[model samples]
Target: MPRLVLEARRIALTVQHGLHGRRRAGSGENFWQYRRFIDGEPANRVDWRRSARDDHLYVREREWEAAHTVWIWPDLSPSMDYASRGQAPKRERALIIAFALAELLVKGGERVGMPEMMRPSANRRIAERMAESVVLAPRLPASLPPPFAPSPLSEIVLLGDFWSPASEVAERIELLAASGAQGHLVQIVDPAEETFPFSGRIEFREPESGDRLTVGRAESWRADYDLKLVEHRARIRAAAERLGWSFTVHRTDRPASELLLALHMRMGAGGTASAAPKGGGRAFVSRGPA
Candidate 1:
């Protein structure tokens, strides 16, 4: 647990440095641009320095100085507890990413909450609050997040394996989107799950149901499994797009920093998942770690 916390903090710092590579956030005090002053506006708000250069009066619009609340959730289902050899469990990795993202958002003057675990706050202690709460929170069924209406225009970040039926996942998100909330889905999977590397005599167990299946030769099923996996991803992606939400995939074996960077950029720009910046570590690589 301690190692995971350390890793989360480290990744947050690394991503912070590269934040400039993405679209600039609007929560800063820095000046963004100047616009023409309108009638009935306060004259005191005018920027005389810039207005002197222009024929018309202008007002300096400091970057939109408003803090937004981002609600984050790391799936606590049994399936998220799976981890392949030498890899971090999906839940651990998801939480790490969530914690790190919360750190970044808080640093950017944004309020962050872990739904029922923690309340949204921009206070510097929010990250620590989130970390401690996640460690002690009781586990719930590995199902879609409980139904709740989000504040209008609020952002939601869901980190999970998302192995649930595509139709069910889509319905949950549709409900959230219906509440006028924007969202980003980060699907975290084990490399082994992405690539069926198992060979002869493999035993498979459903983490949530404890159901088991034994295959005499798993290699023969690899092709079919891969094909089905691709179709599943397409369905998931379509669901996210229908509501203008963004979706990205990550693997346990890869560095979380790259995905974190893309997420930060997308949220900062208020862009949809498809519009999120790409290119690092082959964003959305097929049959490979994302």
Candidate 2:
């Protein structure tokens, strides 16, 4: 009933229409497959009418009804609250994508939840519960996913700026991958962060630590800053590659549907967990607009 939930559903539905229907035969009330009945089969599963049409008894097998849990986490740290003019806050963008992805996944009969925040469930109200939590949740420190043990077969989707040290990020991911879970890393950023478009006499502050530094000539550090930014992202990509996970960057300024579509293609309905590139190249994604 909240505005955020309503808006997220609208966005999701709009994108959903552009997407292919995930209506393949599954554990639902829909028909899946029929085959010749074998010995010792349960009579309840036999399609008597179909069997009558042929000499052989036919057994109906419903599609695999088991759904995979997709654990999603959005960074609620102070840094995620950053927003340049005319753009949604990084935190808001993360939530929009997270909620939209949850809607899509749940619609496809997959379960979704936030790690440590709630249990995974395919219940129709799951997205609403998640949206409420995000709206009312307390702030958390800027940190990587906690080293909690998760269902080995469940998938993990993390939405954040990932400004943390690469080593820390790699360790957390390695810990999860060791449990045999597939993952997708979505690095959400503001255009300002990428461009560093500040000029002379700028005061920059670290959102998490409240550390501030005044630079007399901000333009002088542009080259070095850009290089460091590239190196930082590369490390994150490399970490994801080492564990066979998918990594992509999304700018708050771009359409959320673009990244959402890519996600659906990679791990949507009937799509298995994607593997890391054989050559360790970054997974397919449009680099944020130049």
What are the per-model numbers of colliding residue pairs? 1, 0
lDDT of 2: 0.72
Which pairs of residues collide in model 1? 246-273
Candidate 1 minimal-lDDT segment of 10 residues? 281-290
For residues 1-290, write the lDDT of model 2, one tens digit per residue. Answer: 36656766777887898676444555655456788878997888789999989999997766445546788888877778888889888777777778888899877767788876777876777668897766566655445776677677778888887777777788888888787788888888777776777789988777766777888998887777766666767777787877778887777777887778778777732223333322222211112211
Residue 209, candidate 2: C-alpha displacement in angstroms: 1.2
Candidate 1, which segments miss by more than 4 Å at Cα? 20-67, 139-141, 268-270, 275-290
The candidate that wins on TM-score is 2
Model 2 / residue 90 / CA error / Å: 0.6
Clashing pairs in 2: none
lDDT (Cα, tens digit) per residue for candidate 1, span 1-290: 66777788899999999465322435557666778999999999899998999799998876444545789988877888877789878888888898889888877767788877777876665557788887787866445676677887589999887777777888898988787788999888787777667899987887767777888998898776766666666787898988878988788787899788888888845446563212222211222221
TM-scores for all predictions: 0.79, 0.80
lDDT of 1 at 276: 22
